[model samples]
Target: MKKFLEVAEKLAHEKPLGPKYRNRRLVGNFKGRWECHIEPGWLLVYLKTDQEIIFERTGTHSDVFK
Candidate 1:
């Protein structure tokens, strides 16, 4: 599959800061949008410029990650 550069850059540019355990690694893309994977199997989805909602992916956690 093709990697979405826009989504990748957006996810990289906007990151939630913290003292420890940066959650920024949660970044991913879905349905033409850039999303973040927070919990073990939950996707924290939203538009690039706003907050988001938790969701589920159809594939295994590892498969959907990349």
Candidate 2:
């Protein structure tokens, strides 16, 4: 999970992640949140605000979304 932590740390600092992470804003019911691919099938979802960055979930696409 080291890579995941690294990405999380960057996010907590409000730093922009590289394109390899495929980071993007979420929409639909998940609006206001953000998602990024941590690996081939792994993903991280979180919400960021001025005060804090709230990690929502992390898992494979199906694992987290389903």
Candidate 3:
């Protein structure tokens, strides 16, 4: 299997869900125990195994958890 970060990168080539979340950070709602953060401001999304951005959203300045 691939890590979260890798998954985010593959999203484009494998299953790109672009524009759908441009300028907005949509939660992946990943059903796992790992913690991730969205970078809502660069049109790029990411997930992390520990603390690295896998996919980032480039827009809103709010915490999805908040």
Q: How well does each candidate superpose onto the true structure, as a TM-score?
A: 0.27, 0.93, 0.22
Per-residue C-alpha lDDT of model 1 across residues 1-66, encoded as one tens digit per residue? 122233344355664533232234333345444344443454434444355422334233566565
The whole-model lDDT of each prediction reads 0.41, 0.91, 0.38
**1 versus 3: better TM-score goes to:** 1
lDDT of 3 by residue, 1-66 (tens): 133354466443545444433423344563332232233332333444544435433223344233
For 31-56, candidate 2 gives per-residue lDDT tens digits of 99999998879999999899998889
lDDT score, residue 18, model 1?
36
Clashing pairs in 2: none
> How many collisions between residues are there in candidate 1?
0
Indicate the worst ten consecutive residues by lDDT in candidate 3: 33-42
Model 1 segments more than 4 A misplaced: 1-13, 16-32, 50-66
Off by over 4 Å in 2: none
C-alpha root-mean-square deviation, candidate 1: 11.2
